[model samples]
Target: MFRTHSFVLLALMALLVLTQCTSAPDRSTKDPAEAVDVADQELSLTEEKSAGDWLQEADAAANEVEQHSALIRAANAFQNEHQWQQAAAILSQLAPKKITHHSQKYYRLAKARWAAEQKVWAKVIEELEDVATQFNQREFRVLSLQLLSQAAYQQQDYWQSLVWQVDAQRFAEQRNTDTVWSIARRIKQSELPQQRPNDLALAGWWRLVDYHHQAMTHPDSLTSFLNQWQQSFPNHDAATLVDIWLEPPLKPSESELEAEQAPPEPTLAVLLPLSGRYKQQGQAVRDGVIARTGEMKNLRVVFIDSEASDIESQQKQISELSPVGIIGPLLKDKVAAWSAQPITGIPQVYLNQIDDEAAQNSLTNVFFALSPESEAQQAAQKINQQFPSSKSALVITADGSSGRRMVDAFTSSWENEQAEQPTISYFSEREDMKTTVERSLGLTDSQQRIRAVKIAAGKIIVDEQERSRRDISAIYLPGNLQQTRLLKPFIDVSVSPFAEPIPVYASSATHELRNRLGDSDLNGIIFSDVPWLIESSGKNILLSQWLELRNGWGLSLARLTAMGYDSVSLIQRLEMMNRMPGLVWSGLSGELHIDNSVVQRKLIWATFSKGEITLAKEADNAGSRYR
Candidate 1:
């Protein structure tokens, strides 16, 4: 009887152990306090440091685990300093593991905040959405939804934000919460209309509203888009907003009338290297100046030969003339040498850009160039506008100083304004282009496929797989027509399985789309250039007249003509520009903005279509007298 009792006790004990082992571990549905405790233990610091100092600590950390922990601390430090981008960057590199639920929620919320500060609205939405939906904790979920509403608003999904805001308010009200109710009310009152439509329909309506506003600057593009919008949404309420933007007989502004009435200044001097290697360029300018200002009454223009050999003597002679204003001395070296001295009295316009910082900073004279940088920057801007979501750019340029400068300038503008870094690859010879391009586009992955085939069966066979890297969204080719022609075909083949051609943007150097046969090589390349070069508008008529005056008018010569014409016209209004501080001279070269005696030109954009260069529908930024 005693043995039987012992056996029964042993069985009961075993059954109890099994029951405990098989049962689910209790999960706290509230705050993830264990995770927070872990993070606190890892990240605890005795003394506070500056954001920069914390960043250095994070960088100098001993191992990946320490580095990640230090990065989190650094991000918190940056948040304290309100340097959100720095914080976002520090957090962006960290991939922490073995954290509890509370730590994950805290880290995600912190990341979302920093992302919002960095204007990375998409990231903000993504992080907040994950926290709100995945985590069932009431406090964090409510906070996450509230943050999502604000982030969505910043992302320009106004109606979506409003919906989130409303949802947040309802959730808060059910939980007797007060934090989100006021926010929801404010958003509804200020942002939403009386009639609340679905989010998508509201989004479409707001787009039309934005287009209506954008039409003020880009009427031609707006007109084309509105026509398409009308066709697509004839019965929609947004369609009614189109005709107001499309009405004809747009009135001219006072500035336009003033510019038309503005007479050319009297007794201007012209400096050109009229008898040397630069004579063709000089003569083109002379012809262009003569073509435009030659027929004008009461404008005494004296032509001076600025020979390169005796630049000092020529400049001295120019100074001795003591004319109203000066133009030219087109050589870069001469311009630099001349601008080093103080010419406080006469306002001059140099044809090429001033590279010397002291010269650029000290002189009251204006410097303009047939600037490649301007075209490159415009190309970058156009690419960003066209492909808002695709930020990564790959630049394919010639292996030289010019190409480097173009890439640097383009990258500077793109990274600073658009907030994305661009990859650069250079080619020295046509023979090396294929290899260089293949490496840049990541099409070398095909070699791996070939190797796999060889290892399996000694040759490529049917159903062999290859894939190109999809990270690169656009290509910037700052090379001439031939290089572009050569590089593009290689890129197309490299990215074969992906049918859509990656958008290719080029500078004014690719303006070689004259003949259909020659242009077949440049079918889809977009480039930025002076309107005088691409379009046969009224400006081209003037260029045509200038062209007829000169023989063998190449593209470079034609550009110089436009430069000379605008230079002459700009000096006439130089004082006006200086005084007003917001006036731009609409010249053949571009819309010219002269600030601090430095001339900047914004070129019109164009793209090759069916072997012809066509003016892009979007107008240049049309703020009056602004760059």
Candidate 2:
């Protein structure tokens, strides 16, 4: 029995060797027989070798064809084990010309994958550009198209991304139609080609996105437009995604229709910290709510102290109140705690936002906050509108999480409209502000050059010492009032007198009405803030009372008060706004609108002039005004 088993094993081993020898040679090799012989010899000798061992063999191979085969085998071994770095290293050593034609396709694919991992998007595109169309395997074709699409999207070539994504949907087994639609949505309507592409799929995607945008503002026209679109692209891949794309409204049942028609309950439940360290803030919010609802005769307001007990107890109190809609929880931790739980079917408008995105999936909740990130984003848009000629910007921010969020938001918004990435700098301490500003504006580099020239000449020969960079057309200062006050003057003096004056923009954090004297240094700095505080045209009796008592409540608390007023005003309109995302409400906070269950505000634009705040005429006339 032992002799028979031995003979069977030896016979199987011989068959494996024969199979390896008879395998087809790489297409890249001119001499197919020689390449196959070399591969067969290497396979027989290195049957138990690791990827590392194969790499060493490739480096010490007798000739170029042997080395190419060894390197491709090493890369495949490393990639199978998910050793990305090792695979990338092995792929880098391969010479494309020495590789077999069959192996050359895989070599390009491996190199493109490595580039994608490194986020070298341009390199990914370059590596795959020629071979993408030549791939015969469905998996390879699908992967190539998907990688190219992602690389183009990362490079902000939206049109190319959409084209590639549309092409990918054709070959993929389970088509990601959502990904195709999402890439299409990123493109602006005005940027779409007036003449559709000859590719039917690409043209269909363009028209669908265009029709969706128009349907948002004029929803009644969607059905007719969709019918026309289907007739034009009846055989297109996008036709399969029509139901998901339209997101048609569900028909209401008898009870649901009656509930919608019935009047909402008059009681409104509010959660606030009436007795904790934040009692003063709670009181200010309460005052604002009262000020807004004072004249409403049929309304009953219920105030629950959120800090008095745990979140569970607070929720119990909210249940007992059974109010029409709810608002408050004037702290972040409280808001986050509330968000962690399931919705109770009652509508809520949170005074603060939480970090958990999944918690905000419900349509019954609204996140409304005076977010620094929101202010920074609007500041970017305002700057773009105010200075249409400016292509680049310099952003200086404080060093912390808040600063990071502000800078990220500003960069994303700025890049959407401009071709260049804004230059960014950060300062950790108040004393570092001046140096940070100087370095950001290139004054430090300018001075270093002057000193270099003076040292070379053996005397102070240069008349001019420093000059700000001419490339920066605008500056964004996302700092607090005191920080802005300290940094503005340094920026003012750092620029060379010969250069054009760069316009500076700021967030609401830099705006305050309490100190006109301190604001003198902030002259010519533009900022966005809630209209209730910045503009006098919409002043009410409640706002007047707060202005009279400003000394007691402080400016920060006044902003919170305005938030509370808007929360009450939004209770009845939240559903309507959610349904019609294009609708805007002129509230005390700003031009309020709903976006993905969050209240987005377009604030009033203002600039400092003669030590006093004034409405920017350019903002009012240059299409920045919401109305």
Candidate 3:
């Protein structure tokens, strides 16, 4: 009987152990993703050290032989990092140095100095006057004279800048067959004098060479100019100009190098495929460039239909007229065609940057009006500033090259802004993708911040059988209307799985999101974009002109008109600050901010609710938005 009792007790103990084992596995042992809910609910977004502040650090990184290069690089670094003071400090160091470099170097230094806003005219004039001396490098001297005149004009000494410009022309003409002749030609709106220029040889010595590079369309302009200049005056080195050319634009101030105006009757070739299927965008860009030409002097834009069957044919035709500059050929393919044809010794500012194949052996006097790649990079920087805490930025894109380009640009910007090496998760699709996301946030455990919060919000419920993990803070989803809409349900629904909510961000949250997903679908969702339209405020003397445009031109046309006015009027402000290069470029377009071609006209944070986007608040932040 005792033996039987012992056996029964041991069996009872074994049964009890089995019962406990069979119970729903405790969160501690169920799966790595099981406890993810608890983590996601509690994790808060962490702030990254401002990438904009890297300028100061980079400036401190400058060395001796590479002093100028170091300064330029540091400035570029600061601009890329958005470090305003660091850029200024590096630029200011050169301010006190006597102007000894060639006009090219001076031009470059002047631009950097101007960008840094340290006495632009003072520095420009200081170097220019030295070149003005007959003893200076002949071409550089002439260039300096013209640049000096510009500084003088900037100070409302129009007569002075003009006089100096004439002097520069005379000097460049003397050095005819040199690059300064082009400067004088471009300066004169391409209205070359019947009297061969006498001052072309005395173009920008050093500093001047570096300054106008920002406006150069053809990458070879500087290269070609330097090659000839060095050949002519090899004993007098002008190698420093390269440093100025590579210097980054000001981070705080927007110093887009634009000539005052192009001359009228100046055969401006409209190099766009106006007759092709892609003619609409080409036309749009052409219109913007053309309408503004009137604002410039002697600037008659000749529309050269680049709608030929082949780019080679179009190039042959375009060369005959030898327009002052060519704009458009909206498609890169068209540009590729034009690239095959050699330039007609005329300046060309392409609306887009040339590809490596074309740009490699392309003609002189060519440049990209605005490189989309550059703009994309700028837009990316803006994203980081606007949304610093964003973790996984989802890019819902259409399957195309343009979409890929946008993604690439966003990625570049994100990488530049990401100081912590934080990763921005990307998604490419057009359907329900909850499973993929759940895996990222943590399908099984809930301890990871992104996973835990995602799970807690019920956005991605880790079933008893899933696995997920994510090292992120937020989500970025950028795509077309359809792609964005498809992502809406997944984002909103995934969050629903948790008790609280996780922020889902996008580049553009427009009418498309609400129309498809419904208002409540993207309730707390956030997005940022440069709206096509917005209200404006400022002392606009041209407001009357704008009003007139409103009457004659559509809002789009008015905006275009505004662009011209702003471009012209901005010189006034730039002239006044002559030395205040470090200040931010704030103007009429709300903030008048631009990373590159992608200007941040306005960014309004909104939540979709009931087919309407409600602007949450006005922002005075310095950085761009999150992805």
Query: In model 1, what is the error at residue 513, expressed in angstroms?
Result: 8.5
What's every prediction's RMSD, in angstroms?
Answer: 16.8, 10.6, 24.0
TM-score (all chains, Cα) for each model: 0.57, 0.58, 0.42
Model 2 vs. true fold: TM: 0.58
Q: For model 3, state the Cα shift of residue 431 in Å.
A: 4.5
lDDT head-to-head 1 vs 2, winner: 2
Per-residue CA lDDT of candidate 1, range 252-283, in tens? 68887676665445677888889988889899
| Stronger candidate by lDDT (1 vs 3) | 1
Q: Candidate 3 on 1-627: residue-level lDDT in tens?
A: 236675455334333322332242331232222222221122111213232232232233222222233234444443344444544544455432322232125325335344434545555555545435543446445544655666665554433443465556555645322333223222221121233223432333322333232223333354455456555554332344334434564543233224324333556676666676755555555545544566566655666666665666667777766575555555666666555564655544444445454354322323333333444454455445545663444444455676677667767667423334433334545433555454445542443554556667785655442323233444555554556556666655444343345555555423341242235655666655323222221233354444454443333333333333333223222211211111123333223322222223334345555655555454356421110
Clashes of each: 1, 3, 101
lDDT (C-alpha, whole model) for all candidates: 0.64, 0.74, 0.43
Candidate 3, residue 534: Cα displacement in angstroms equals: 5.3
Tally clashes: model 2. Answer: 3
Give the best candidate by lDDT: 2
Rank order by TM-score, top first?
Answer: 2, 1, 3
The residue ranges of model 2 lying beyond 4 angstroms of the native Cα positions read: 1-265, 387-391, 416-419, 455-462, 516-518, 537-541, 617-627
